[model samples]
Target: MLDFAKGPILAIQEFFILAGQAVRNVFRRPHYGADIALQMDTIGFGSLPIVILTGFFSGAVMALQMSRALAQYGQVGRTGTVVSITLVRELGPVLTALMVAGRNASGMASEIGSMKVTEQIDAMRALGTDPIQKLVTPRMIATAVVLPLLTIIADFTGMFGGFIVAYYLLNLTPAQYWHTVWTALEWNDVSQGLLKPFVFSFAISLVGCYYGLQTTGGTQGVGRATTQAVVVASVLVFVLTFFITKIFVGNVVS
Candidate 1:
């Protein structure tokens, strides 16, 4: 049992140590502004299509599903309320983070893992370069900066998708759907929506980086790291969102 627990405990300890060093490096000198921008473009813009598609379809489906239930209560016109609240409070950030994790987290792991196996990271260290600052910190900053924006875009696109369904299939007026969408959002919903993505971004970036840096066994290890990064990052998104929502729920109850 001790042996069984040792590996996971050590990995978690190393993960936090790497995370701390990367975050501390954020305020240090020799800032990699260019790398940060590049990562932002890669993680943020590269993710837009899937994020948009997921948000749109999820919202449309939510509206479609909920309309029937609402209709049973003669409240079909309030589909926007259900769709908006669900998207903003839960779906938008979680879906976007999961999509990003599948795409970029794996990419980060593979890229960095390849570099590690190739000894490129060692070469950087030999040349007096800090690999964490050059590689990890920039990715972390970029994800942190860009994720909330992606969540916002996802939220709006989702609301728009819901609006389309509500307007056409349900025969809800555009004003009515938009009004409910706009009015359904409370500050708490918006706060959590934005906050969830910001937190998930760290898990995605840092977990990927940590696994990449830990890679061994050459090419096979790179593949393993990539898979682990995506799986862990995706799981963390769901786990983190649940806790964040719980906090908000507790606050609201109080």
Candidate 2:
């Protein structure tokens, strides 16, 4: 029997070592410019197109669904509010994080795995370079800092998407939709959603970098690590999303 129990145990062990190494790397290497570039690339540039597409589609669908559900109650006007609020508070960050997990996290893992397999990582150590500080730290900081910004962009774009669907496709008056949105949303929901992405960013970066560092064998092992990194990072993000939502609902936004 393939022991699924072993998976979580091994993953937990790897997480601690990776996290400690990442912290030490931050103090030792201090590659400010590289970190900035990585942040820009991972959080901004790579995430932009996917975020836009997902935001638009999700907003449109949410509006349509809410409108259908509310029609029976003569509350179709609530579509904008529901769509806008949901997008900003949940869908935006969750979807953006998923996309980033698939894109940047997997790619980063693959790159690092290749480096490790090629002995480049070993060479760095031989030449007195700190692997944790030079590589892992910059990536960890980049994703951690950039993910929330991406989520914000996604939130705005998603709201805009709702506006388009409600106003044009559904023939809702612009004032009516805007008014509905303003009344139904609270600041706390937005705040909670935005804060959650930082946690997701940390998970993605840590999982990707850790898996990469642990890569072994040859090209096949690197490939497996990349796949595992993306899969595990995405699952963790969703789990965190659910937990954060629970916390937000129970305490913060209640």
Candidate 3:
């Protein structure tokens, strides 16, 4: 029992420590501009289409289900309002984070794990490059920057999807749907909507790098790290989502 318990406890400690180091490196000297640019392209541009598709479908389905529930109260026209709020405040950021975690986190772990298993990481250290600075910091910075942008795009796409459903299936005029969505959200809502993604971005990349760096047992270990990164990052997105919501919304604990 103690061994089982200690495993997760140690892992958690290592994760936070790694995250702290990465955070400090982000603002420090010897910044790897080229690597950061490449990672931004790899993480942000590469993940765009899937994030858009996920957002669109999520909003459409939200509209479908919410319409039925609100219809009983004769408030089906408010679908846009609810969909916009839900997407911007929760679904957009959370789902985008999940998708990125599934796609990019696994890739991060696999790539780094492969290097670790093959001793390439040791070669970097031999040449006096800090492995953490060269390998991990760039990824951490790229994901933190990219995920928020993706979340913002997802929020807009989701709102657009909701707009389409409202315009056609629900027979709402385009003007009415647009108006409701815009009016229902304020600057406070937008700020809160964005905060979750920023936090999630850090969690996903840090967890991926943490697991990747710890890889062992050769090829099989790389595979295991990849899978574990995805699972852990994805779970963290949801867990962080709740606490973030509670903190920003400020009524959950009360």
TM-score of each: 0.98, 0.92, 0.96
lDDT of 3 by residue, 42-75 (tens): 9999999999999999999999999999999999
lDDT tens string, model 1, 195-226? 89989999999999999999999999999999
Output the lDDT of residue 149, model 3.
Answer: 97
Q: What is the C-alpha local distance difference test score of each model?
A: 0.93, 0.84, 0.91
What candidate 1 gets wrong by more than 4 Å, as runs, is: none
Predicted candidate 1, C-alpha RMSD: 0.7
Q: Which residue pairs in candidate 3 collide? A: none
Q: How close is candidate 1 to the true structure, as a TM-score?
A: 0.98
- Candidate 2: residue 242 Cα off by (Å): 1.2
Cα lDDT, model 2, residue 191: 85
Ten-residue region with minimum lDDT total, candidate 1: 147-156
Candidate 2 ranges with C-alpha deviation above 4 Å: 1-10, 24-29, 252-254
**lDDT comparing candidate 3 with the true structure:** 0.91
Clashes in each model (backbone N, CA, C under 3 Å)?
0, 2, 0
lDDT of the structure predicted as candidate 2: 0.84
Which ranges of candidate 3 are over 4 A from the true structure?
251-254
